[model samples]
Target: MSLVYAKNDWYAIAAADEMTLGQQRQTLLLGTPLTVTATDEGVVVRDDQGKTYPYQIKFDHVWTALGDAPRALFDIPEGDEPGRRCVPCGVVRVKCSPLRAVENFLDIAHFPFVHTDILGAEPHTEVEPYKVEIREEQDEVWATKVRFFQPKAAKSAGSGITTEYEYRVPAPTVAVLYKTCPPKPEAQDVIAIFVQPRGEEECDVWPWMALYDDESSFEELVQFQQEIFLQDRSILENQLPHRLPLDPKMEIPTRADMTSVAYRRWLKKRGALYGAMTEVA
Candidate 1:
């Protein structure tokens, strides 16, 4: 019998800061050499020649990393129309690697299980699907818009948290995003975007930004969220064969694996699937 294995997460190779204009970097996306460049106009990426390409805009406070490379932040042109428009979204483009980790992490279905130490510790919790909107300009790499919502009774452990998670994945390395304003005045809200490698084994993380509009203090709220991610790293980094292999029956997933499973399905459909798909071999 033959079993095909895939990865459940995506690996980030470099950040915006590590790339230079007209320079090329090697990446592991589908075991392919993905090249990125910073140009006078913005950022352009090519695979195996001038074919399959897209250009991005450069702006201030923009940072990114690619496959074990250093991080780089760029300066945007003054009064530049395109640059100005692209800055708020935080990213102009991104390349979904073989891991499909980006979509997996965001799949609300797994929150209660995979994140048992954090969001999943409580009972009867689930993420409600909100909306997904996408827009791609002519000759653009890929532009995606996503929205997420949590109902009032969704978070049993924490207080009722309701807001939209918006994202614009402009490049394989950039994400522009923000959170919608909460209807209630006393609630806390955060708008943020994160681009990091699947695990410590990979390289740079893109510009990670967290913007807040609510009045609740940012101290504990930020720390709480940060700790959750850190916890994920601690566990994910220690697993055997950190990167996904093609053999399906190498590992075992327990009851807490629901989130991982759902995320895997999400990425497979997006064409960025990765990780070992096994039932405790």
Candidate 2:
């Protein structure tokens, strides 16, 4: 497994509301210990050696890069849409590679087995053919036209429906999913999963959502999202080899794994070795 992390990228280190003035918290990103402090100026992140790094507050989180950043954080224009609730679902720590966490977020074939009635159910386990591509203009991976049957697709969903989905990987450790919204059938609910690599085989995942829901309370929405991801945590931690394999030869990829394949290819092309195993014995 390659322990080299692509440092030239922004990673969500802490939720905005979690950081208070004059408070300091210790966290890890890309296996580097960091001291995060909230000040009048803004949130400041420092390495163990007391070297301060550049930081930005966006999407209700503090993002920082430990190396020379290639660009700023990816934009989510939908968050500013009218009548949408931007919910920060909080962080989930898992004993697995961050790359694995992001890949799992992009998967729909496991919905029936892992998420059950919430995201999928038995007898409707098929993952229809989807369009996967690498947009050279933005240098990101996108999977569209993905459809799947779900019993309770969202917190506002009143009945089972076939959810149309679009998955986007803007960064190595970040993935965004756009799925059908029950309340607003014309619009889609946005769920973004940002992972912080605490170690080569461990990470803390932050899930943020923007939904057009007027029925569910804030607490109810958070609980629903948390329950769904907690179920996934079990499967992620139990997977063999912990680190994700970048080589297709290391693990067979079926038709349903097209998104995963594209993701691996994107990572390999960019030479992202952190939390990636190029070969398996």
Candidate 3:
């Protein structure tokens, strides 16, 4: 797999709390060196050569791009809704391709095997049929009416219940999940994974949430998300081929993998080749 990246896009490299006042923090995104420093007014970002870059603070992280002409970041309307508990679960560095991480996040069929009783259990291993499609208007992949039985859907969940979910992939490196909120039955809980490409086979993933729960503490919420992702990290680090294979022949897909197939096609269509294996010349 070649180390290629779509440079003209925003990626979350560091947590908002990481930028200490007047202290410069540096990192690598898509294999480019970048730095950030906190100030009284705002955060300042610079390249390895000390040249400044455009940046914004959203979803409790600093987003910036390496390419000179970059695409605009997507908006998360739920981030502003009143009474929603916005939680940043922090970052987890994984030794796997960023694209692979996003693909894994879009899958739920592994719950019964990987997540076990926490997310699913035996006899409830079947993944019901769901609809997946690419929305041309937004250039995003969407999966609707996804339902699964969970032993504990969330930290606030008091008992096992069938959970309804919707998945959206707005960017090549980001995945947004909308699921049923236990407390607010009429509303949904939004959880997202922002992948910061560090190298072809490495990335720093940040999980965030906008929930309607009032029962779980901030620490509890963060811990709950961390536990699930850490379990995923183990599988991510050990998968063969490191990068994702866009060629369907490289790896077969099932009905449950429609979102993944849609994602690969979307990446191919957009030429977002970082951390991917494609047959296209």
Candidate 4:
């Protein structure tokens, strides 16, 4: 895939706690070297030549962009809801395209194979038809009515149960999953995946979750989310081509891949070529 980083959107670089007073951290996004530091005023971000860029602190992370941002960060209303545990499950670095990481998060077919009994089991390997669409008003891709059987849908689950899911792709490298919460049957557990494209072939993924469980400790909640994402890391790193192919002819899509297909179309429509492949001339 040819690399063409999207510069006009907010990308989460580091956890808020990672940047403390008098501390400085350096990272790369879309091949651009970035320097982050904490000052008396607030967090500051600059480029290699000391050119400062605009940034904001939200959802427990430092977000910045390389070019003019057309909009603010995507909102997660659940983050502000009382009694919900807003947990940040550290970052996981993978040697794959950021698009691939987001696609994997939107896929439930892999649950039976990659996630095993925790997310799915044999005999329930079938992925029932779901709805996928590009919302013109919001300019985002949405997948709804997705259902799956999970032995442990969340850390607070006591037994296996059927989990309903809704996936939203608001950006090229970001996706959020809303799934059934056993403890709070009326509400859904929100899991958001934010990918920072370190390069065309590599990325650092940050996982955040808002759960209704008050029974689990903070450490346990983080560990539970980490365990699930780490399992996906292995599978993502081993996929051939490294970059995601935007052309449908490059890979076959089945009923289960509706979300992924819609995502590729969304990216292509916006000319987002970062970590993406186009037809060779």
State every prediction's TM-score relative to the real structure.
Answer: 0.41, 0.97, 0.96, 0.96
Per-candidate clashes come to 42, 0, 0, 0
Off by over 4 Å in 2: 1-5
Q: Which model is ahead, 3 or 4, in terms of lDDT?
A: 3
Candidate 1 lDDT over residue span 56-160, tens digit each: 333322222322322233222222432112212222122223133343334444555555534443454544434443332311122123233333311122343
Q: Candidates ranked by TM-score, best first?
A: 2, 4, 3, 1
- Encode model 2's per-residue lDDT on 211-258: one tens digit a residue: 999999999999999999999998899998888988788888999999
Which residue runs does candidate 1 get wrong by more than 4 Å?
A: 1-101, 113-121, 129-158, 166-168, 173-180, 183-201, 214-222, 238-241, 244-281
Worst lDDT 10-window in candidate 2: 1-10
Residue 98, candidate 4: how far off, in angstroms? Answer: 0.6
Q: lDDT for each of the candidates?
A: 0.37, 0.90, 0.89, 0.88
lDDT of 4 by residue, 45-135 (tens): 9999999888888778899988764466778888899988899889989999999999899999999888888899887888888899999
Residue range 49-86, candidate 3, lDDT tens digits: 88887788899888988776787899889999999999
Model 4 segments beyond 4 Å from truth? 1-5
What lDDT is reached at residue 213 by model 3? 87
Task: Give model 4's TM-score versus the native structure.
Answer: 0.96
Model 3: colliding residue pairs = none
The alpha-carbon deviation from the true structure for residue 37 of candidate 2, after best TM-score superposition, in angstroms, is 0.9
Stretches > 4 Å off in candidate 3? 1-5
